[model samples]
Target: MVHTRERSLLPTEEPLSLLRKDGSPVEDSPLTMPDDDVLLELHRRMVVGRRFDTQATALTKQGRLAVYPSSRGQEACEVGSVLAMRAEDWLFPTYRDSVALVTRGVDPAETLTLLQGGWHLGYDPYEHRVGPQCTPLATNTLHAVGFAHAARLKGEDTAALVLLGDGATSEGDTHEALNFAGVWRAPVVFLVQNNGYAISVPLSKQNAAPTLAHKGVGYGVPSVLVDGNDVAAVYAVVREALESGGPTLVEALTYRIEAHTNADDATRYRTSDEVAAWLDRDPVDRIEAYLTSRGLLDPARRSAVAAEAEEFAASVRDKMNVDRTYDPAALFEHVYATPTRHLREQAAALAEELA
Candidate 1:
């Protein structure tokens, strides 16, 4: 059974930072913001992620990839959170979190291969320490909790960061994971990208709670809501929470600003005016403005960054077209570390049927 409780507050109100919207700083945000170099890096990653998402969507439309969930406006939350992790840390990502995987050093080629259904798994989990993108919604949260629990038992200081959407918070697995993490004091960070929609369901319809971060209080996990469009805020919150060494939930309140996936048409549920309002507060634009105001970005450098991102996207597109075929017999390889007799018989039957 899951243990549910009320959400608790951080020691300070500074956790929820809404700074630097529309190219300017708000009067009341965390005083210590990121340095110029760090800000530039955030913008760079955001650009790269956006470019990758565009390319992936195009590939999916071309029938080269099976599916894609674009992180168009949500780049900051993913890149910033992933950037806060140490090299030794583990990341649990959802299908929409390819940007996080990319930032965590997963190869784009392998990621595309996994998305295209060419491989059951992408990169070797041991090598990259990045697990396969969990497509089954909030179920991966439990895996993150369990992994952290095991690591704690083994006396490892490593942490696990799990990324999911706002819609996922409504799932039973999410609640169970939170309860487990809180009870055991697991070193897990739950990063909820509240993009305002869980496919067709709006956030209002997903949960009646005022905020997802508040839900963490009941689980004894400290939680905060941040302007998800602001990469700096995301990095700061995640970095601090990871250092605190217990489960924390960051509800990044941002909008999708794009379709749920290539298969989804968000216009059916949301209005164009809503999408336009979010576009006005675009994460990429905010960073660009900040960089420009500080003289860290100029027209020439901006053009170069865009060109480089495009080149990277083009390379991924070319790589996705390359043949990376696998043997039909290998389909049964990783189902179990040691295949059971039942599985073996089923594999043989399937192989004979195909033949």
Candidate 2:
């Protein structure tokens, strides 16, 4: 007997952008006029995120942190989407989303602690309204869907913004979460930072389909593609989606421009020429140029922002150097609200070994 094989459903590529690479408005783009203040804020946050990435990368090399994921080319996507969120809304971030976490009011010190592996997490999720930085790729999307569903059941008006990468879309959890969010009409934003590669696997190899945004349409969620490097576009799309009060999938077309993580070397898989090409369209430079043209950012103000970022980076470095010892027993304590017998036994055994 012959069996028929099921074909995988994939998303189609969609048209992108409310703004051009040169900050020119795309006539057909859905966004109307861009606010100057919003643009400036986006630019500032991008600079700050870039600075953080740089410092984190250096810290990893110096053995201060276990690992680091550089969001160098994708700062605008994170900062922009973060700026669109309300304080009460929850942010579900991947390990690479340090910028989004910081923009959503997570302390720099807390982020450093998490990155340096001093604790399972540095901040209370309730206090910051940000979920843990999930290291398991696309698993957090389902968590965001559940959180949104719960919020809806509680009659809350807030939404949940879930951040994932292009590679994550390939994960089973990514599709399941999207399906659940759509079926329930959960207030969730599925933000896909399409940085062109999933580790060493380029987007082309990841899927036969053109783009991740199209994945939502079949699930009954509205989707959009945006210039991930253009903070204005990201902010506009995210804000509109949040206001719409339903699931929205946004594929931010950007580039990684760095290694997947500090432990991985890009030189082995990707070429320097590719990195240089993306750097030429650096999101930070684009926003800075726009601000300079509009006189929103003068040299003095720009210098001030740069200096502030430098100081912040220094503070993170200082904090990372501090004593971060934790009780060995505490590890088993937070493993569950109530520990199971096996966990308790393991914890006790570990504690005795340490003692």
Candidate 3:
């Protein structure tokens, strides 16, 4: 049977943007622009998130972390996505989005636990309303939709904001989740960080749509595209989606400048020149330029921010350096409300062997 291929009927629209590579505004400031303080905070958080990624990569080299995924080039996308949510809103992050979790108030050390080979998830998902950093592709998209649906039924004013990569958009679960969300009008915002590559597979190989945002129209969900490297643009797009009380998708056109993870080598598939061009559009540099132009950031403030981030990195290092001895039984603790007979027997056997 020949299946008719789905294609984007409409040409891709121009993505919304507030800032450019030079940090200049794309248009005049709003009546109430993001205050100098909010802009500074956003800049500070992005810098710290970059430092966290670097420190985690270093830990893997030292054999401290089992694996590390550097969110180097996509900081603006992750940071902006999370910061756009309200404190009470929910976040569902992918394994590649430790920066988003950190931006949403997850402790950096705890956020890295799953990546460090620790037992179960690293932090209390309830406390932060941040779901586990999903390793299995597109699985948590379902969870995010369900949670938002439940919140609507409960008459709660919360939205679930979930993040995924361009590659994850290929997964069947992603399609199903978005379909259900559209039908139910679930209060969920899906952030697709279209970083060009789903691991080593480029978007051209995996996607045929004009833009990832176009995927939503089929599901009766609206979508917007953004310059993912622009913090202002990402945050603004996400901010609206989360507040609208219906499913929305934001496709951020960005690039993953690092290997998929510590274990993957990107050099084999991508050219040095391509990576170099992205380096020129680094989000951290762009934000700094904008802040400087507005006179919100100066040399002293820059040094102070660097020092603060360094201190945060040092603390994460110190915490990770301490040896952690997990109780084998804890693995059996959270899988279910009560342990199954088979699990109980296995847990007892492992305990006996250890004893």
State the lDDT of candidate 2 residue by residue for 1-355, as single tens digits: 0112111233334445656667555676556535887787787788777888898888889998888888889898899899988878899999999888878878877876777877888888999899999999899999999999999999998899999999999999999999998899899999999998888898888887557786777898887777888887788778877777788898888998878888897898888888888888788887787778778899998998899889888887887777666776776757788899999889889978988
Instruction: Compute each candidate's TM-score over C-alphas.
Output: 0.93, 0.93, 0.94
Poorly placed runs, candidate 2 (over 4 Å):
1-15
- Candidate 1's residue-wise lDDT over 119-221, tens digit each? 7886888788887789998989999999999998999998999999998899999999999999999999999999988899888888876688878878888
Runs in model 3 lying further than 4 Å from the true structure? 1-12, 28-33
For model 3, how does the per-residue alpha-carbon lDDT over 1-355 read when each residue is reduced to its tens digit?
A: 1112222323147766788888888864221235567678889999999999999999999999999888999999998778778988999999999988989889988999999888778899999999999999999999999999998899999999999999999999999999999999999999999899988998999988889898898998888788899887787778767777788888998989889998999999999999999999999999999999988899999999999999999999999999988887777888878889999999999999989
Query: How does candidate 3 score on lDDT?
Result: 0.87
Q: Which stretches of candidate 1 lie over 4 Å from their true place?
A: 1-15
RMSD to native, candidate 1: 4.2
Q: How would the candidate models be sorted by TM-score, starting from the highest? A: 3, 1, 2
RMSD of 2: 6.5
Clash-forming residue pairs, model 1: 5-218, 6-217, 6-218, 7-217, 7-218, 8-217
